[model samples]
Target: MEFPCDDNRISIVDLPEDCLLAIFRKLESDTDRNSFGLTCHRWLQIQNFGRQSLQFYCSLTIPNLSPLSQVVPNINSFHLYRLLSRFQQLSSLSLSGCTELPDSGLNPLQYFGSNLQSLYLDCCFGITDNGLSLVATGCPSLTSISLYRCSITDVGLEILVKACKALKDVNLSYCSLISDIGIRALSRECHEIQAVKISFCRNIFGIGFKGCSQALTFLEADSCKLDPEGILGVVSGGGLEYLNVSALSSCIRGDGLAAIGAGFAMRLRILNLRMCRSVSDESVVAIAKGCPALHEWNLALCHEVKLSGWEAVGFNCHNLEILHVNRCRNLCDRGFQALRDGCNRLSVLYMHRCCCVTVTAIELFKYIRGNVKIKEEELMYIGPKWPFFR
Candidate 1:
């Protein structure tokens, strides 16, 4: 049987090498590119050279990663650290959920030490302080490190800060073992540290930001054991732009909020006080009075915040765009009206589970110039299910 072929047809191979590469670059998706590359040897070579980031999901066997590394030699962003020597230009690596990646597997990363900058080992349960110590020693150029739910402790953190002086952003969220010692070490050593997230670290207390980097702009210590002193230490740092002190119900009070508002008046933009039950109108008033640059405020589950506080925020924070007052049971129609009257720039308002808030109250937000979007939950029924039966 004769195969159908047009005599005048110009095949893709007939095109110039550069033109072929340009065509491959426009493929958009990696899968499509890979498929196109597999069509011919030249396309494959072009794809390999042009490839910048590569992700291998559960495909890499811990014992032997040579085959995969040999497959993608020019990858800069990698998931597996097994044969990093092959990829000298590697800059970002994420070993998230790589349960098989043990301490010994991290040895390969030493080859790309100087080149690697962003490292994420989130939820890598096997990675302990020892493994991280190796990481610190190897990846000295690391600027961003996220170890969410990792087994790393203050010891590992100390080692990391001691070695990685260029470190700017670090996330130790859910690192339960981390405490004041580790945080203090970071503050003392890493002067370039801009953002530190220690949320859900229950053991952390008294993380004094007094001596820390003045470059520190973002701090997230939600659900931590930070007291008033700790809170003051953070706000007093004078460079904070984004602060999330949510769920510090026991330690944070009106005074602490006021201090934050006053200290970070011009810089403060995003403030999250979720589940901070102790915070009342007094604290909100203080924030409104001080933080003129406030844009996003999350007072979710803060039961104490009433109409007065909402009004204060709306009236004071002119730049406020997103406001989350979810579960603020005290918020009513008057509060919504106040918010509408004060916050002209308000665009997104979340009032989920706000039992006292009526539809009539929410209607007032309709007149907002930019068209305000209000997210609310079903009206909560506080009375007995069967009044007659009761």
Candidate 2:
């Protein structure tokens, strides 16, 4: 922005930093602040940093204007667009709890949706397949979207991917209606998607991710009722850096789980299998061989894994930094010794109610490696007594 006079001229860009900051302080509204930032990249950077000292938004105060959620039902598309058009630089929109906002409420997005890159509709129960279609049609530039607990099925998912090819991160957790069919659509169509969180979506298995093999890195799909084949499908991509398939119980077969360490282990850094009761030493040893680069491992409540497994972890996974083996019933002092001896880089160790591990072993490890942070509790109170091989 430039101010011109007959003899002299000055630009907003030429103003001193202090003058710019002083001028920005007088503007209170988010829209005004947003407009101030859009003058140039320098002003945008300054506005973002300066907001910490002089801020805007309703917060706990009275709504300066009608809250967007309250006006959803009554506001017409034209009025809504006219109101939202004030903030020409709006990039992130969160309507996480507008439970009653029907599909028509999304019509306003079409008018000013190009500026939006992230949309969060978590727990919006009224957003059916039709509503998501509106979102896909309106917000073509959306790179990240969360549909947590939304009532959308495969049709809605198919519609979304067909329109928004730039989607990189999506959250479908607890979206009970979605299944592998919907996921396959996402996998095949959205080539740029890197993170997919599908926790508690029981119908989906790892097989749907077969198409996201090239770019897939982070996957968190805990308690999805995965079977043997499903477990195998999870590691099939092998490019994953962080993987969590925790709480997978009775349905998964031993051989299927063991194969994760044997064949599919790529450059995995973090692996979480907490409460997976069927994880045996075979799987553990195979994991040690397959994923020697593991940095953080959580085997909490894994009663089936014994000393051999611990020994393998110590000998092979030298890069191991943090470990959680709380309630591992059979892991004794020798098992602890293997970890103490081999995992020199071990920094954080969590062991509570590991009854078979005597206090002497813990004390000795502390004496040897004083830097290793340990989290433990007295086991005598609740640990199994001589009645069951204490």
Candidate 3:
């Protein structure tokens, strides 16, 4: 037999292990990684070792825990404690929508708390205050947690903030039971908190945000009963980057918006004022002048703002990229033209339900290289479907 010693005949297996690992790292999607892993045993081992985050979504079809236990031996009896104990290297764990998971399932987490950095328990209705208390006490090193639509109340939140002082981000959105008490506790205890989402938590008011940590950057309180006082309290923190006070028609007015424009001038990047009927041209102009860093802005259904205000925004906020003027009956072609002229960086424009915006002005927007989603009715008259229109 003749031995082939040509360089062109070198197989992929001949490459160094570190080189193969580096190649695998370049694969972006899980499907690509999995396919690469099946090529060889060494690749499979590297892929398995690279997998550090685990997520489990139990279905009613597999109601019995026996089959799941066979697949993931550590998750026997739906006990999270046993699972965490086995996967000591896990940095992130998500048990979202696990309604069957009980309080006892979290008891063993204390042993592996230091290893955990992020946890998601969204819509886990079966886990009550007692279960949440166990999580707070156990996960001392946790930096982020999401309890969206959970049954956790003020008592559970108090326990969590007290224990997880290192927490940076939290999401209590749609948690109906969370009130001012819980918000106050979180603000006072978690001084390092950066982002919070409390939208649809009806009981939360402006007072809940008072004296919040200066480190606070993002806040979402849409569809809540937040008043001007609450809005003032949030802006007073000064480090805010993104703020959503949408649908607070009864509370937010010219004064509140002016306060936001003044306080968040340097840091504010995104602002959502959807359906804030009280917002007028004066306040809009004030916001444009004050917030130079403002990029993405939503003024949908704010009918009080006219062409003059938008013109000012275009001139002042050069960095503005996204603008939503849906249902703003007062805005006309002249205003949009001014806006287009001033805001050279405008990328996404929503002009649905604005009857005053003529087809000529819409055609003018076609020249700009960005997305411009108009109402279906408006598209019919425009003839050719542009690639940018959606």
Going through the candidates in order, what is the number of backbone clashes in each?
A: 0, 0, 1
- State every prediction's TM-score relative to the real structure: 0.77, 0.79, 0.76
Q: Where's the lowest-lDDT run of ten residues in candidate 3? A: 380-389
Best first by TM-score, ranked: 2, 1, 3
Cα lDDT over the full model 2? 0.76
What's the lDDT for candidate 1?
Answer: 0.74
The models' CA-based lDDT, in order, is 0.74, 0.76, 0.76
Best-fitting candidate, measured by TM-score? 2
Which residue segments of model 2 deviate by more than 4 Å?
A: 1-80, 377-390
Where model 3 places Cα greater than 4 Å from the true spot, the runs are 1-51, 59-78, 253-255, 363-390
Candidate 2's displacement at residue 285, Å, is: 1.7
Q: Model 2 Cα displacement at 149 (Å)? A: 0.8
Q: Supply the global lDDT for candidate 3.
A: 0.76
lDDT of 3 by residue, 235-302 (tens): 77778878787887466666566767664546888888888887878888888988888878888888
Better by TM-score, candidate 3 or 1 = 1
